[model samples]
Target: MSLVDSLKDIHLSILPQDPVKIDTFVFRLHYFWTVSFILVFSVLLSLSQYAGDPIDCIHDHNIPDDTFDRFCWVEGTWTRKLGFDAIGGQMDKAFLRKDLNFVRCFDESTNSDGKPHEDCWQHQYYQWVALVLVLQAGCFYFPRYLWQIWEQGKIQSLVSGLDRTSLIKGLQSKNELQKGEIKDKIQLMIQYWREAKGTNNLWAIKFYICELLCVLNVVAQFYFTNFFLNGQFAQVARQGLNLDENDSILPILAECRLTTYGSGGQPQLTSGLCVLPLNIVNQKFYSLYWYWLSALLVVSILALTLRILQITSHDMKKFVIVYFYRIKEFNDVILKRSNHGDWFLLIRLMDNMNDVVSSLFLDELEKIKPFEAYRADE
Candidate 1:
């Protein structure tokens, strides 16, 4: 069958009748649902910004109408002659400035032409940041997908059967015939457990692989995000803050100016600049990245530690039970009963058998043994 079909079947089969009893820690710790929510939020934020123009040119307000019109006409004609767009059309073509030098805003006293304009650099970078957030969310969820694909099916099957058997055994207590059937089922379960023990190492390896992926995903996010932000104006913000690369936090908003050198080697004001338009969105997103990613890292570490502890504890318990059974068999005294009473007790203890099933099996064994003893006495 196709993977999608198998996943659908697994999801349908694992739905618990009593939802309260279902353990959701695995789902939550896997981080798929949480990351998916973040992805959706980022997509919506991007769409909202897309509905309006993110960048617009800020024209110089100090210019007089007649002089400004003549100046614009001359500049526009020259720009068109040079194969550049008209001044009005230039407003729509605002791209991120690639240089490190800041622009100067127009000063009416120092400059003759009031030609300075500003474009929204923030708008351009914010879109990229939004895309990065989506990618980060996918990284958070990929490990969970790996687990579901590799291990979740086997885990769900085992847990489902255990739950079903426990429920049935609980309900069958008053009926002798049903109790006998449960006894047979318990024996089959014990045999399955014995066979499953041989593959315990294989299961442990699979579990560890998923655990490692979870850790690696968090580490990759930390470095990848730092690289992405630094590559896109984060370094410029750091320089503005007078902080080194290591000490600076990612800035959501910054202002810069674009200047051109005049013939006299004086800096002429060309444009006033505002970088990163969606400041609120970026601020919230980065704040969440700092807090949420840190918390997730801690939680993932703790979850992995707990899983390792659980596996160790389970292995120790199994070893102790098996050692005791071996010792009992070596002594041969447990074999004196000759009616499999001791064998049943050992199996029940070693396999972590249900108390009800153990009691029913012991009671039936007692009844049969006493009848055989009476017959021998006669």
Candidate 2:
């Protein structure tokens, strides 16, 4: 016996007398739930922005900010910032035509001068947009809530139904039972456990995707906040410049009796228009929205991490047991077998493992706080 043999002996000494593999059906269900979350959330976060006015939906919060090419088109890869004074392409023509056609039609119907019609169009457009934004936001949230409820129930069912110890004991007793009976019982149990393990992994993957989307949202939000701010400020500055161009500082200065100092006595300013409307709305809404979005992103990230930890922890435990057991089993029952076709030892080891795991199932699962509460309450 060399180092390998010595190590194998050490491993066998530490191995549990009985070790259980995760239930396959439970694992598969977990994976399904996770995959469902990924599909649902990915669609919600990525596509909701397009739910509203296709032109302005790019600005909607329904879509996760992190997604690229969904917003105003850029030549390179996806980016958050709505860059360019105008979307420089034929698309701009389409937008301008659409804007002008609607505005002109409204102006004609109202039969009013340019200013009032513009104001009316602005009000109507913004109000319609606000409604659309709200509806788009709903598309993402409603499905997720419903799925969470459904998953909660299914997880409970899985926890309650699994009886691996009984399953293993039944399999062990098959030595005296009919060959067909034994095969059926053992195969069914193995199939179920295998599926359960797959489900767990699937869920873990979905949680990971959710976390990634959350990170992307944070980045997107940051860019959108800046984009909205700059546009608002630029609009204000343009108005200010127009007002200054119209008014002469010399006259105001003379009226206020400050002309005695110099020719450039005062700077022109727009009275009662200290703030731009959109700028104010942007400042107020974005700050509050940012806080809320950040909180949501953090929650999602934490949920994903917790899910991954749960799935991985179970896997790690199973691996540790299998790794050690395979070595010991190879040296003992496997090597001593007269016929290579006699896999009885392997079958017995698997059954024993299931028995051990089934015995401790609830106790180990309860360590997961979310499930613990649910189990206790249920």
Candidate 3:
């Protein structure tokens, strides 16, 4: 229909289908979207950079092709002659942040001490991008994996038959005994949910911690990637939007040099200009990654802050319960007696279960007489 819907369809088609969603939408955004983006980018970049000649060096007329290419690609390449150093912003010399000026097809001069010139930054990070992305995907996935194991289908076990509106409608056709069995199952769910207090606050604190971990991981990944990319990965998107490439860690062109004996055994010095196509792809990938991760960070921070408010503010919790599920008629008794863990489980139920089932659950919970006394006895 629309362009947005088409894109959504494309994204969904690539994602692995799961019958049960154990996490929230923002949580899924972290582990699913972030991880998927990394893995896909990693594979694509690997294909582009590794499957062909990633670096092509146009060498001196006397130099052999194989020697120049191999030496530069394997050892390293450098931007020998840097341009005017005045960039608009603060210069980060730790990562060889320099002006975008690669003039001519010649090599840089060695220092009097035989070392590479100080201005020439060695370019060896082309092959490292794919591996870094793979590692980043693993980092993004750890929180989800831990939560999946800790969740252990607790919500699924409780919300089994109560997931759809049709469950209530089908109650009309069931035999009396069948209806009784279903009601018994609902009661069992109520019992276990109430008993989650006994079972380590319904494991609710642990789940909230996992969610917190997701947000922390998102923030941490930014700094980690910046370090990996020589302090330029996080700023790539903003810098790209401003049309600035001087400070970019991934350079487009660099210089390569090789010294070897000729066919006649005379010592020869060869210098060439290497055009790096892989860095072009790398800058694009990191720029895209920057935008995605920035959006995810804002959303996760908002979600996590709201979660904290819901836990601390009774009015906030009540508003959420009433607003999301249309459970406006439920008694206030259960809300008074329920702890954060119990409320957390109920919120999960409201999230996963159909309106009819969730409302029915609230009705049953409200009818639990003097739940405070029941708690005291327990």
The local distance difference test score of each candidate is 0.44, 0.32, 0.70
lDDT of 1 by residue, 306-373 (tens): 65553445443334334633321121222233222223223423233344433443344434443346
What is residue 121's positional error in candidate 2, in angstroms? 17
Q: Please, what are the lDDT tens digits per residue for candidate 3 over residues 109-141? A: 434223565445566767787888888888887
Q: How many residue-pair clashes does candidate 1 contain?
A: 5
Rank ordering of all candidates by TM-score, starting from the highest: 3, 1, 2
Worst 10 residues of 3 by lDDT: 103-112
lDDT of 3 at 83: 38
Candidate 3 matches the true fold with a TM-score of: 0.79
TM-score of each: 0.49, 0.28, 0.79
Best by TM-score: 3
What TM value does model 1 have? 0.49
Clashes of each: 5, 24, 1
lDDT of 3: 0.70
Q: Encode model 2's per-residue lDDT on 311-334: one tens digit a residue.
A: 345443334234634321111211
Number of clashing residue pairs, candidate 3: 1
